[model samples]
Target: MKKLSSKIWSLIILFLVITVVFMSLFTNFLYDQLYVKDSEESMIEVGERLQSNYQGGKVTDEFVEKVEDFNMYSTFNVFAVRNPKELSACVPFEIDYDTLIGPEERRQLLKGEPITKIGYEERFEREVISVIVPLTDQNRLEGIIYLYYPLARITELANNEVIILISSVVVFSMLLAFFVHKGLGHIMRPLNELQHAVEKMSDGDYKTRVNVSSKDEIGKLSEAFNEMAAAIQSEDEDKKTFLATVSHELRTPISYVKGYSEAIQNNFIEGKEKDDAIQLIHREANRMERLTNELLQLAHSNRDQEKIDVYPMVISETIRESVDLLKNQSKHKEVEINLELDDSLIVQANEEKLKQIFINVIENSIRYSNKKSLIYILLKASGGNAVIEINDQGIGIPKDDLPYITEPFYRVNKARSRADGGSGLGLSIVKDLVKQHNGKLLIDSELGKGTYVTITIPLMEEL
Candidate 1:
């Protein structure tokens, strides 16, 4: 395969070479016609000048000498005609005026048409451009004036000019090719770096960066690529951290469950001791179950959202149910409950998933709320949405943690969470469930104040 630079250069050079050849041929064709036309016009001018010199269709020897001198100074092959019968020459040429100037031209000249033509003479081995006029004496047609220009000189002049034009084109093309090559190199520099970056990323090295130097499209692309790499690196680091946390979380409980079960099976305890062992195994198993459930929820959230069954359901009733379920738990925390709901807060949602969303959020609030502090559950139809907010007066989530509070396995206070048996998937689950119902989740909090997790689900049209 050809290298990119080689391919580009070859294509450019090919186009330029073709252009050069085309221009040469085209200029060749056009220059001849242009030269012939110009020659005819010059000849007309000379013929008019000679008309002033002629006297009654008769030219003196001096006038003839002057005509010959005029021919020598200029670039014309000259001849004179005294009517149709008499002809004279100022220079040597094979074809006479009678044969060279056609009767058709003669008729046209008699009728006041300009005599001009382009012809080739076999004897002279050259093409000719000619112009003839009626010699006038006091406005009376006396004789004829004929002037011819040989094309050999015009061809020489055209050849010289064509060479100059082609030379200039070659120089310009070379410069253009140089500038284009430099420009492409500048553009491709970023792409080349990007290739390496992508390759490194594929090899699991995500810390790749590209240098951006221009404000052009290629530079913008480089910027975007860098951003993508940074995001991937962050996600990869987060994944590793998550795995380590899960490993520690899983191993501790599994070891407890295994050790306790084995101890009981071996009859290592009796009476209260045996009961305690069984309870310990049961608690460890429950911990494992919670962890497993969280993992499963995280894994299947996207698929569950895809298969969500949306129907109009009263959000206020769902909130009441969730509040009731958490009633005993909040009471243990000595947390007072306050509910404000609009009964008409109906939203398009999957009932089971909606219930689960409410359960997770309320449970999170219950776990975090300060003892004897108020937990506010508000549900109202606001702007065509069922707006549900769970506010807890507790150790609020830090401001810095608010953005990532809903990410799976993200915990603001890991120690407190572990002590409370919190799986860290509650808000994450709430977020995904809300999304399944085409809803938005927003968590607002300031450290030491309180946290408010608001869910907005599209309200069903009350028909």
Candidate 2:
């Protein structure tokens, strides 16, 4: 089954409702106009028949009998009045004379003015169309005749007209709806194709393109979608090429460092000069090891479903261990690393990875701090998480370099970084490890003041 879009469905429903309502109103208006004219003409004929009876001087008992009999079969009420006082004298019908006609209406009839009124009457509980005419003999007003016709027949005729009009309208409306729907489908065929093409493109089938020949908005949209798919395909190819080149370039140095370090360690050289060379080789090996580890971590982090092992570990203990490992490196500077933590504070994390996280952050602090400057470590639970902050007063990173500080191999000052024996992968590893624990790593630094690295991890369930 095909599903219609909300926009199209709404338009269809709106169009159908409007067409129905408009046709109903138009049909009612046309029928009312036709029935009004017809009823008025019928009323005139009834008035003429009453006038002819009066002019023949048929104003006797037999004539009154005929009028009384006429009221039983016909829908008109006939009355013959000589004057306002003798209104009941000439009329034989048992009529409610006063209730039916007012004094002003009688006066107008006597003065040779014919009266025609069409209105609703409360007494009859229905509408009446009355025609009153003067009966004259020898240029004198003999009497006035009233012809009252009930509007029931006109109402019936109007009802029939409405029924017929509605039936015709329904039939026509159905036909119109069918044709309109078909026309709309024809117009939207290209849009439907364009939509299918876009779906294919979204599913990575960039070769799909819409063949919209019309010079309209939909056509322009088709052209733009094709162009976008082409551009995305080109970008995807370029990214693959760049990643391949970067992988090849990074692996070559790592291979050399590993090979030479292994050769030196295996006694491939000897003597004091060889010892120095071996030490340099070992340093290069460690540097390469750091680089390779960062690359692997980066690849793992980029995966959508990388497995992470989380557990409880003491925050203060991790910091103390990391500082002790780098204590010899900071001996010449007399750098003092201090911890401000609660003894029982713990965090949920991967234990080994969290240790590496602490090592990278603390080592970066030692490398950048001024000689003899103190590195402060603070650990506490704040806002439902265990927060560890490392603050160092050093030549802080530049403002622009701060954003890229955690990118692998990115250095704020390359010369200074190399002097500190950093491969520029420390902070990047810190960031990845923090993320693996479902934590946040924040860096705040001033140009000359110092830099602060804050790592926050969710507190363990045991508290």
Candidate 3:
């Protein structure tokens, strides 16, 4: 909501105005002083001529003629003073000399000291500027020369200079404002795009992106924005696929249950056929129940992160138990599970979750694995940890799909997975269950070369 551009522009203008105004004032003051000094120096030259040419430091007719000539040729009101208080040799005085020159100035000149001063005279109703030069012969005061230069001339010139300076300041300020506005706009353009992108994302448009090329902060922000959008887009896609997979899985089982139940009720089949149909109906119901149970497990995991009842348990026994439990299923698939276990392999884990982890992994191997394939189940204590490695000669997952093989509802071969009665949550559940026991789960697979899954857990003592 706060305008950063306006704030920056205001500071820039404030600096410019302060600098320009100070320069203008100081320049005008300097110009006025130098102008007055030049005028005084010119009068000083004329005053010296008059004093040197005078006899006994007094102005003669020739001197008077020269003064008239100097006045005519030069720009000054020239006069000669006999004493401090009176004008002796002269021009027709428009302003009384006694009233025009101050007593302090008159005394200093009459005592043979030359003084130049600038003042305003309300008595003469005009501003006055004058240079007074003392006439001295052998250091004795004889007469003084007064040179009057019009102060109006300096004011007029200063006014003209000020007008020009103000005009230039105005022009420069205009240019500065224009460029600053443009520069700020360019800098903020990326940020504006980012804002729009965020708004689009908020509105559930995950495809939003900001196009930026510069390698500055704004560009980095744009890149981050795009990355976020991509992540959200990917999750959204995964969710849709999951929904479709789940819908198909649920619908198939329900269709069988509904069809078989209706058939049994309507006597559509004879005795043996009816029994087979009921068995199929039970099988479909069990499949649906298993799917729902896995879903509930996922939901329970999300809801109860700290619900695990962890304890020190022997992993070898747990593995043996899980293998025994799946013995019939493995026999049906003609899969040979080879067990290599270390009895000392004990770990801190939730017993139920550990059993579940092993069950899911072994079931997956049995389902995907080719008939009569060897499934290696190995457990050992190594480097202060209990390690479980399961390598299965299943129709192995694709090399590219190894990374996402543990994601919920992610199947390497969708059709094959579905045919195997896989809701695609088996590996995902196993992964979560192992993690709940503070274990690391690693999977490596190659197409047609089987898959290896390793679980590493810190070994707990017999306490």
Candidate 4:
């Protein structure tokens, strides 16, 4: 179970959204404040103009005409002059002026104090700001001049500002999201490759690698991963060499013991016969002990490595050596070993492991081949790989067992394998060694015909 790394752009996008939201709110607040101040100033100026034009005279049609002209130029609606005993109104039509002006503000205007107030006027069903000014003639209080101005225009402007601010914020957010997604992808691309490499390693693909050239943290991580894989690969190669050496050493002693044991049992010498038999037995016991130890070492070498070593070697040499090693087993059976090889057939591989691969193939052939049967070794270079095929005229393996031949400890005929002294590890070892060389091992067999094992290794030049 693995988890994907968190993306950096997600955090950046969140921060951008918060900042944009805060800035939009602040801008709207400032705009509303400025608009309110301008509206108030316009209302005050209109009220002063009316008071200046008509303050010295009594109410007349001429003064009403002046108020109407001022109303056309300004936002003022309700204009009235209220004296101590009577009220002279120039509202252009009949209306309740008292209701439009709140009582407290009206009282302040009548007391010679100019007042401005904002309230909803019921007659118009709208909100308005009113400005009131006092008029005086010859040192006596003549009347109060009141002006009403609707706040709808300011409200509409503020609404438009909010719409524009919201639209800007949305646009900015979308652009930020796009850029953030792209930047995060750029940063995480190497990490994604590293992750895939790790998965391949888990599945025993040790040669998996990541190529990321950068001076950043992700690049550093890729470098570290490659170093670790190389170290593991080196250790693995050392282990394989150690196992091959040990296996080779044990084989000589095993052959000697088997040879002497048969010689003594057949009485090649007459005197001290029992002693010779005991000595032969001792040698055989010791040989088996050494062989078992080598097998264990080979098994330990098969553990997972972070990387693998791949090189080129002659396939013909490997097959020839394997056939010569097993030639003794073919003595009584009259098995004919043949080679069909390309002169320059070379493959990328571990040489010793490649030798072991053919040893396993030929040994299996010797064990199962019918008396006087032929075992053919064929080699070809094709499609960037050197293909080595071992064909044996033997008691062919069962179809069901063919698929599991490469699995450790699996055998088609367990009783036969035991009788043949096989530990059921040959094909498994062959498969592992071939994979380490970045190659494939294929087995094809029919019940009555014969079995063919094909080892396909990458060509040296291709590597």
Output the number of the lDDT-best candidate: 3
Q: Where is the poorest 10-residue window by lDDT in model 3?
A: 86-95
Give me candidate 4's TM-score against the actual structure: 0.48
Those runs of model 4 whose alpha carbons end farther than 4 Å from true positions after fitting are 1-130, 134-306, 332-334
Backbone clash count, each prediction separately: 1, 0, 0, 1
Q: How far is 452's C-alpha from truth in model 3 (Å)?
A: 3.0
- Expressed as tens digits, the lDDT of each residue in 76-157 for candidate 1 is 7666655545544343445466665577866666664567767776756887777777765555555666677667653466
Which residue ranges in model 3 land beyond 4 Å of their true spot? Answer: 1-166, 265-270, 299-312, 331-336, 369-374, 393-395, 398-404, 435-438, 444-450, 460-463
| Top candidate (TM-score) | 1
Q: Which pairs in model 1 have colliding backbones?
A: 334-372
For candidate 4, write residues 279-318 as lDDT tens digits.
Answer: 7668657656745754663575477432556566777887
Query: Predictions ranked by lDDT, top down?
Result: 3, 1, 2, 4
**So what's the TM-score on candidate 1?**
0.70
In candidate 2, what residue range of length 10 has the lowest lDDT sum? 87-96
lDDT of 2 by residue, 1-463 (tens): 4556446657888987898799778866765576555666665676667666664443565554565566676666766555534655543333455755577866665566677767676656666666667776655666566666556643465577788987998899788878877877877888889788878877978778777677788788878877887888777775676476457545655676676667677888678757776676667667667667776866676563348876677877877877788989678677888789876877777777788888888777777888889888898888879888889987788899999888766779865665466766678777877887889999989988789999998887752
Displacement of residue 212 (Cα, Å) in model 2 is 15
Give stretches of model 2 more than 4 Å off.
1-280, 304-306, 415-421, 461-463
Superposed Cα deviation of residue 353, candidate 1 (Å)? 2.0
RMSD per candidate (Å) reads: 5.8, 13.7, 6.3, 14.5
Model 4 / residue 224 / CA error / Å: 29
The estimated TM-scores of all candidates read: 0.70, 0.48, 0.66, 0.48
